[model samples]
Target: MKNTSSDIEEYLVNVPEERKEAFKKLIETISENLPSGFEQGKSSGMIAWQVPLETYPDGYHCTPGSPLPFLNLASQKNFIALYHMGIYADPELLDWFVSEFPKHSSRKLDMGKSCIRFKKVDDIPYELIGELVQKVSPQQWISLYEKLYKK
Candidate 1:
């Protein structure tokens, strides 16, 4: 099923008010910084920013059934999550991020296959995150996916 911004907002019901505001602010910041042609939408119940299908006929691999760009943002009860499909498909990028922002042995990076989870706004290095986001152009991301997935 297609996800919508309202769905994402509804899922955030359990999030604390303060955290909700912080998450919203972060989302706003990301929205403002995204390159043109990237539209805001929702997928899998998470807020997403992506290039429209008209821009990339192949569609977003992260959400294979959907035709939107695949970048995702979502909130869980404990943390806010950001996902870039390239993280799982691009080892160099993942290695660079892990090395540059080394996590302590005691505290994991709280990452899934592609998602990065932050318990609080302060937990994230905003500048580094911004740099990472900027580095992945829509076309470049598609190329990376093709190189890695061969699809």
Candidate 2:
């Protein structure tokens, strides 16, 4: 269920009213913790936090036109998805999240390499997510992204 809306407000309008607050909270957590240079708006049909094209003109390796994504949040039919690039770029961060999240959250950790699925708001480990979001600065992410592409 990919919503084609490019505006964050338009995208949120597609989100069910009941889940809107949760989505906003997720946005807040990411915004509060994200590094100083990342921009927040819409990208990839969702609310994306990223290093703007002006900041890193090289963009994503997979999509040259798209900005280098740091985090993305979307409301789906059944759940909300938070895409955290930090964990994808750094294996140790993923390892720490997998081992530590469950200790603080009752919900089982549901995640892929970069996407963390939250079936309910409570399924989100907000504090841990914030910590993860803050682990890398925008400059750091560019370095990591560049390093990966070099290989």
Candidate 3:
């Protein structure tokens, strides 16, 4: 479900009790793996880690007043969602993830361009996810963003 909560804590509080621990674990993994200069906040009804607006005031394309989103974790109606911006920005990264995920995970990867859906907590490949999250630092992300879309 789309959360209207303004804070991460508040957002987590609204998650179903049975699913809260998994969500917390996801948050912990994200917190531990993210590179420097990413700030955690609420965006698009999900918990997001982004390049702070102070670092790049141009912010997101859709929401220029908001920070540029890097990763977003959301509890969707049917599954948990992890949006990794690195994969979206770099085609090689997405290809690698698709090729490598099945090698390491028993669960089928449910994904779009960048959104990975987890039907159960066990469906997550924590190590791979962490590695993917760590692939780009804030500065690198900004560079990639500008290179791809700064026209």
Best by lDDT: 3
Residue 137 in candidate 1, Cα distance off native in Å: 0.5
Model 2: CA > 4 A from native: none
lDDT of candidate 3 over 69-124, digit per residue (tens): 89999998888899998898899889889998987799888999889999887667
TM-score for each of the candidates: 0.77, 0.92, 0.95
- Candidate 2, residues 10-87, lDDT tens digits: the string is 888888887888888888898998879999988778899999999998888788777888888988778899888888
- lDDT winner, 1 or 3: 3
Displacement of the residue 72 alpha carbon in candidate 3, Å: 0.4
Off by over 4 Å in 1: 1-15, 61-65, 102-108
Please estimate how well model 1 matches the true structure, expressed as its whole-model Cα lDDT: 0.69
Every model: Cα RMSD to truth: 3.8, 1.4, 1.1
Better of 2 and 3 by TM-score: 3
| TM-score, prediction 3 | 0.95
- What do the candidate models score in CA lDDT, each in turn? 0.69, 0.85, 0.89
Rank all candidate structures by their TM-score, best first, as comma-separated numbers: 3, 2, 1
Candidate 3 achieves a global lDDT of 0.89
